[model samples]
Target: MRTNKQVYRSGPAATKFAQAVKVGDALYVSGQVGMDESGHIPADLAAQMQLAYVNLEQVLAQFDASMAHIVDEVFFVTDMQDFMSDAAAIYAARQAVYGAEPAVCHSLLGVSALALPALKIEIKCVACVAHESESHRAKASR
Candidate 1:
């Protein structure tokens, strides 16, 4: 028996958690908070959301994956009321990176609190390796 499970670390969170993982052709990214390169959460929800999504995209790229490969995404926001105000901006940020990629299963959750009060948003994702099926089939044929 064998398994394919690899852990990856990136950015300021290298010590916090393996930012991403690959298990049997599936990529699971841990929740990413909205923090800047200097590890500070911005004061605005829109800013925070943009940073969080950017962090997710950059890390995914390191693994040869992109938002287009994403199958599931869970977004956590601090205030549903306030989130509404910046939703358009946040959406724009995501679009800037993802472009016209097919929509992935998504959930927007309003939470009373996040990892920190200053952190306005967090994003977690599960994606399929674009080559997963082909790799699995090739391995089986060998």
Candidate 2:
């Protein structure tokens, strides 16, 4: 059986995996790293987390979704000790990005490494979009 889905690509543009995939109303965003388009990786963990969220947001925009649409997320960090050492700063940065406490399920896991040696963190997200008809109805009511 074939399932309907949409995919968005970034990074090398020739990589085997897509940045995000949308199936029906649900979107699965691949793990986003701190590396920017110019391939710069910041040293600080909080800085890295912020940049990763920026990358994730860019992917979400491709599907007309935003952080508000995200229902779940998983954070993979290379150094949990370092992460926990500055949990306040890291979470404060996150709260700033979300504009408040994120109303979503999430997990944090310590990893040995990422695709790049310099990378410290990667964030994966899952988002839900409103059905087209529902979106239209909401717009009509407004």
Candidate 3:
């Protein structure tokens, strides 16, 4: 059986594939890269990671969700050695993005390449979104 899904698309890849898709309480986000809306990518890994998180946030916002809703994530890096060398800066940028230690399952993998060779990293996420009513009730309880 097919499941009903809500899809969101934007930027250059709009016709390529949805940036995110929601089915029930779960939102599946596609791999987000450091490329900006104008297709500019930074050479620094940390800068790229920071931009990628911003892109991820935009995708989540399309679903009325946020990074807090994220339950799992995967990071695909083109160069593991280079990534590790800059891991501190990258993680620091991530911490700034999340505002706290993110509570989520995470995986990091070294990949040979991404859709764009200039891209050093891609971040994919899965989020658990509460229904409107449930969200309201939770806020009320708090």
Candidate 4:
């Protein structure tokens, strides 16, 4: 069976689409932007990247998953050159969360603009529910 859910915060505008859907063991996360729970974008690229990842984390957490469960990621940025540092920072953060495996399937794209003016980065991810046999899940429980 499949399940769908919309994620939102108190003061933020309602999400335009479903934040995540779970089909069997996999979770598909919708595109997440660099905005806070109140929908305000941060000023710097690094901050925006952090915020975007934070949003992604929130969605994943709903499924009892974390970045360690992420098997794929799609990243979008307005200016590739200007955002490389921020991208690297996000990558580092992912390394901390997922160790090495979650870095494998990643795509980066240069986009004209995001849905919001202040959003410089957006990210989407796909993750699996932690199986009892998974090593990562064992580690997380410790």
The per-residue C-alpha lDDT of model 1 at residue 22 equals 81
Q: Write the per-residue lDDT of candidate 4 for residues 82-134, one digit (tens) a residue.
A: 87755567677756656564654889999999987888888888887644224
Local distance difference test scores for all models? 0.78, 0.85, 0.85, 0.72
Estimate TM-scores for all models. Answer: 0.80, 0.90, 0.89, 0.74
Off by over 4 Å in 3: 132-142
Residue pairs in candidate 1 whose N, alpha carbon or C atoms collide under 3 angstroms: none
Model 1 per-residue lDDT tens digits across residues 1-142: 7776666776655788788878876899999878977878889877777788788877677567778888999988878888887777777767776786448888999888987779878999999885644433343355
lDDT of 2 by residue, 11-49 (tens): 695378988777889989999999888989999888889
Candidate 1 ranges with C-alpha deviation above 4 Å: 11-16, 132-142
- Give the number of colliding residue pairs in candidate 3: 0
Count of backbone clashes, every candidate in sequence? 0, 0, 0, 0
Please give the lDDT score at residue 70 for candidate 1. 89
lDDT of 4 at 106: 87
Q: Please identify model 4 stretches exceeding 4 Å from their true place.
A: 1-15, 85-90, 97-101, 130-142
- Worst 10-residue lDDT window for candidate 4 reads 4-13
